[model samples]
Target: MLKDENFIAQNDDLDQFNRKRPQFGGRFLNDESEIFQYNAWDDVEWNDEQKFLAQEKIQKNCSKLMPEEDSELLENRAEFFWDEFYATHKDGFFKDRNWLFTEFPELKRFSCSSSEEKCQNFQILEVGCGVGNTIFPILEAN
Candidate 1:
């Protein structure tokens, strides 16, 4: 019963609504659930294979700045250094690097405003942001 333009507009609205739906990825918490099922942090320990895969990813990503030997050392030392660094600086160590908006176009989809608007508002929260590395990169890219 709808006109062609109206059907197209309704489909577009439905698509937008589907895109905006929030997704939850964890198991439900309950007394009947197994310990591993309830506790994501405890259940998510990395095995040797996973660690090796991560090491491979690091090697590939940072091949320019890190030789294999130095990369291994850097990866090992990163956890300790990050913890210590954040302990001293806490929230003050990072400056908001919002200039990255020009570099990463994918982030534009997260903007609340229309695409025509030059300034798009976005809220990005980084869980386990680890000395703001991810946060800084995203902020810089935005």
Candidate 2:
């Protein structure tokens, strides 16, 4: 993950939130239109209503994933459940997540920065990297 110290920030308005625009690469989003300016997570300014809605969603998703029978088993052994599930089902579940570059531009240092550039021996560990679908494209892109 990219560290916070690598970013440059700007806050023109005292009432508004501070923005940390990264200098590692070019513009994070490809769009030029003002309408699409607030597309990224950092660009978003969450109001109280949005925060309440997000909390509700968190409760909903957490409740859905909780196992009623083996409630005690999932206390800290959630990984065991996922391991068993993937072992049984295998790679049919996940396809490659090709949007790693778009979402996290720091990961696309070599190719996205310039066409002539190439990267090697870059260490990255993606948690919940099911069946290695996410990392394969990043490795291939390298």
Candidate 3:
């Protein structure tokens, strides 16, 4: 029937629209029952109740005060703590972030290929490199 054909056409149009829409990733939370199944969900829209509860929690925590001495002590000992952490881990704690190439395509762009000459002038100052996890991968790539 013509009605059936029109319905199919409308569905095709909807499918095309959905295809054209930007996809953050394939791991979407399509079902409420599967919410607890994943550690993280991509492009999730929170319900009003969830949003309200999050706002409530944020408001409750916003007014909490830390002792000035405790804050100062932590700030003063931050470098010593970081040094201790680095000494303890010794570059074994963090995983090499291979996702950096996908996340930052510029890393790939700036990198020289095996056929190309290696760059001596490429200077990167990575703040908080944290045991060369980021810089090591960059070095390997470049």
Scored by TM-score, the top model is 3
Task: State the local distance difference test value for candidate 2.
Answer: 0.54
Clashes of each: 7, 0, 0
User: Model 2 segments beyond 4 Å from truth?
Assistant: 1-44, 53-69, 74-84, 87-90, 105-120
Candidate 2 per-residue C-alpha lDDT over 4-86 given as tens digits, one digit per residue, 9 for 90 to 100 = 22221111121122134433234444355655665343444579999999999999987776566678878569999889988
Q: For candidate 2, what is the TM-score?
A: 0.38
Query: 108 in model 3: Cα distance from truth in Å?
Result: 2.8
TM-score, each model? 0.23, 0.38, 0.55
Candidate 3 lDDT at 113 equals 32
Give the better candidate number (1 or 3) by TM-score.
3
Please provide the root mean square deviation of candidate 3 (C-alpha atoms, Å): 15.0
Candidates 2 and 3, the one with greater TM-score: 3
lDDT of 3 by residue, 1-142 (tens): 4544544554455446445543335568778898797666667788999999999999999889788999998899999988998899887787664355444545544533333557446777777845555776555443
Q: Model 2, 111: alpha-carbon shift in Å?
A: 8.7
Candidate 3's C-alpha runs over 4 A off are 1-26, 31-39, 109-132
Error of 2 at 84 (Å): 6.3
Judging by lDDT against the true structure, name the best candidate: 3
Question: Which pairs of residues clash in candidate 3, taking residues 3 or more apart in a chain or in different chains?
Answer: none
* Model 2 poorest ten-residue lDDT run: 6-15
